[model samples]
Structure formats: C-alpha cells, structure tokens
Target: MHIGKPHEATTRICQASAETVEVRGRDLCRDLMGRLSFTEYFCLLLTGREPTDNQRCFLDLLLIAIAEHGMMPTVQAARMTLAADPDSLQGALAAGLLGCGPVLVGTSERCGKLLVEAQSRLAAGDDAKVVALQMLQDIRKTGGKLPGFGHPVHRPTDPRAERILELADARGVSGPHIAMARNFRAAAAEVWGKPLVMNVSMPIAAVLLDLDFPVATIKAVPLLARTGGLLAHLAEEQQNPIGFTMAAHAEAAVTYKNTDEGGG
Candidate 1:
C-alpha cells in the first residue's frame, strides 16, 4: 500500500494515503523588492494588478494624505472596538469601518465629480473661472464645505496637494482638467483675497481624473487607502486600551435655537 505517513501541510479524508508536498520558505524582505511601495501594494491587493510608477506615487500620496487625522470617526471606531477586548487587527478594522459608514468619511468621490462637472462646464464654452467661482458660491450658500478648496488644519496650502501637484507638473501631465483645477485655485484666492490652496481631496480627484478614473471612484480610493491607517490604529488600540470617545463628544456638545420663534 506504501501508505506510511502524510506530510504536515497535506490533509487526508478518512483514508490510508500518503501525499508528497513541497513548500517554499518565504523571505519577507526579499518579497518586497520591485513589489510596489505600500501605496501600490494597496492597489495590487485591491485591483489585483501592480500600478505603474505614476500610479504608485499617486497611490502613495493618497494613502499618506489621510493616514491619520486626529482620531476621526474611523479611527475612533477601531479604538473603541479594541478597548472592549483585544482582537485581530482585521477585527478592529472592521469595527472602524462600521463607524465610517458612508456619511462619515465619504467625500472624495463627490469632490472628484465636482471637478468633472467643472471641466464639463468649461468645455461647454463657459469660462473656467466662472464655473469654479459659481461652484464655490453654491457650496457656501448650501452650508457645505467646498470639497477641494481650503483646509481647516492647513493654511496657505495643503502639503499633500502641493506634493501631488508638483509631481503632476514634473511628469508634464497638463491637461484641461488640471488647467481648470489651477484656474479654480486662482479664483478662490481672488475671491477670498488669500490663497485657498488645493486640499488633499483636490489632488486626489485631479490625479484620478487625469488617470481617467470616473469621478465617482475617486472618493472610493481614499476610503480604501484610509483602511490601512484604520487597521494600523486598531492594532495600536489593542496594545493600549483607549476606545474612541467621539460619541461622548457628540453628546456633550451645546445647541442653539432661533430667537425669532413667535410664530411657533
């Protein structure tokens, strides 16, 4: 029968059989060469293909841009989950994703769409400045933060946006969309009397549009990249138990009421 033993890696089902198996030792560091940087590694894992150098750089910027933003909802969720009881990194991340539901950390795609719409308005014979200015005005009227314009944390210019724009310029990647983005930046400065340099989402949207990704997908890339940081934070929380406290922040905040309430 020649069935003395079976290899550890192989499994047998209720039968007397021996199987020969071959295994290769993995070199953690060696597997990283030419394997794309962390940014491209994300793409490879998600899209099942390696991104080109430009794509890699773009992906890297996107990942780093939103890697952490001072205990945002996603990070809070991850930490909170970890505090209950330490678990696998993936488990903690899952908790964070639960908190980042569509409304929380989902605006990149909308910003991308805004750029596409801005480009379309310009292409249809409208002045780029006019279109961008009108968009800014509309955002203000609606109490919506202009997605790719100014940043609350960064003044003068968002560092990530500046870097992406520099890379795009160095690569000689000028086009109508890029030109429109520049025009938009100029218009914002003219209206505000100060530079409202592009924010993180701006360059992200610009790069995706340049790469021909649908505007809607631009936001998705951030969500995807931010997961890496979310996972990292969750792992961190497991080591040091401090859950997210945003819910408490939300509950303890103040509220205001309209004074002209005679009609009511």
Candidate 2:
C-alpha cells in the first residue's frame, strides 16, 4: 500500500538534457557561469528571476553579516561532528544545519512573519505603536516571547542589525516594514518597561521585506550563510581536532544528583 501520493513528480527548477543543463531557461555553463555572482545566482535559483541591484546588494550584505559569529552552537556542532567522523563532510554540515531552528539561525523567518503581521494591522488603520503593543500583549498572554527582540550577548542593539538598517536607510530601502520594526522596538520598551535589544533577525527580516523578498524563503538566507560558517568550522576542526575534547568537557561539566544520597 502506498502511504501518500506516489504519482506526483515534477521539477521546474532545472532541466538537463544530453549535452546541456539549464536553470530558469538559462544555460548553466555558457550563460551564467562567469556572469552571475553567487548571490545573484542564488536569487535566480530560488526565485527563478534575477534580483534588482538593491536586492543583490542587500542580499550579499546580509549573507556576509551572518556568515560568521565565532563559535556559535551550530559551528561547535559542525566542528564536533567533523572531529568525530573526520571523513563525512556532508554529515558534518548536515549536523550543523539541523540545529538551525527557532532559537538559532531560523529566527529571521519567524521575525519576518511577525513584521508582516504587524504590517497587516497597520494596513487596517491601527497606529503602528498600537499594533505593536497589542501584538506584544497578545503574545505575552499566550506565554510567547517576541521574536528578534533580544540577544544573549548583544545588549541594547545588535551591531549587525544596526548596520543593516543603516544601509537600508542609505539605499532608500527602509520602508513600511522597517518602520513597523522600529515601532515595535519602541512599543516593546514601553510595555516591558525597559529597552530590549533588537537583534540581527529583525532587521534581516525588515530589510529583506523592504527589498521584496518572499517571506516563505526568509529562513533560507540564514541557513545559507550559516552553511558557510559551518564549513569554515569543519575545516578548522580537521586541522585542530577538538570534537573529543569538547565531549570530554561536557562530561566534566555535568553531575548527577540523587535526592536521597544528598540528604543522607
């Protein structure tokens, strides 16, 4: 018995024939090989269209901004995975990418969706501050935390986030979405009675939204950037060998506790 649909199979992303390969109707070898930057090519591959100049520039900037954050959990996972296997590069990379979830590199997508929700409220004629506050209140009532509003290490603001917004302003790409993010920041401070740091995810979402990036693919930006970082870490892991040491450190860092034995 078939578990699901078994007869559906099609791909519009690429078509290859006996002598040539094509992506989005462009010849891979002759038309795109040296002409498109990797960022431009990534845009094409994902959206089936080339990005505008601003889109390309911001995309490249965001990628660079997120590519390396020294010794992040994903990097450590990749390093340890490489150290354990020492042969399976793909496995090591997969180990790292698997860790990109709501708490880590995946927050950009969630924040983008949140901003879009706020934009909808704005479109409905509510003031930006009201929308932000109501959204925060609603999230809090449900025991939910606001996405993209705080970082463990970066206080007040994330420099990468600030740079992205600054560049967006300079390039005239800061639009309603960015405005909504800033309004959310202000509203969060008022609601929480303290200044909460705005991390890179918010601006990553805001600027990408301003650039007309598809919300569905927002997470891909971080995933792709972190892949590069993971590769770098894996390479260094091969050279320096730390996976076993990290494992040993973890073993030493934890202790089992028994209530009866402790009381006795």
The lDDT values for all models are 0.68, 0.90
Ten-residue stretch with the least lDDT total in model 2: 255-264
C-alpha lDDT (0 to 100) for residue 193 of candidate 1: 70
Candidate 2, 111-188: lDDT as tens digits: 999999988888889988889889988887788988998999987679999999899999999999999999889888
> What TM-scores do the predictions have?
0.69, 0.94
TM-score of 2: 0.94
Q: For candidate 2, list the clashing residue pairs, or say none.
A: none
Where does candidate 1 stray beyond 4 Å? 1-50, 88-91, 98-105, 141-143, 192-194, 244-264
Estimate the Cα RMSD of every predicted model relative to the unseen true structure: 10.7, 1.9
Q: Tell me, by TM-score, which candidate is best.
A: 2
Model 2 C-alpha RMSD to native: 1.9
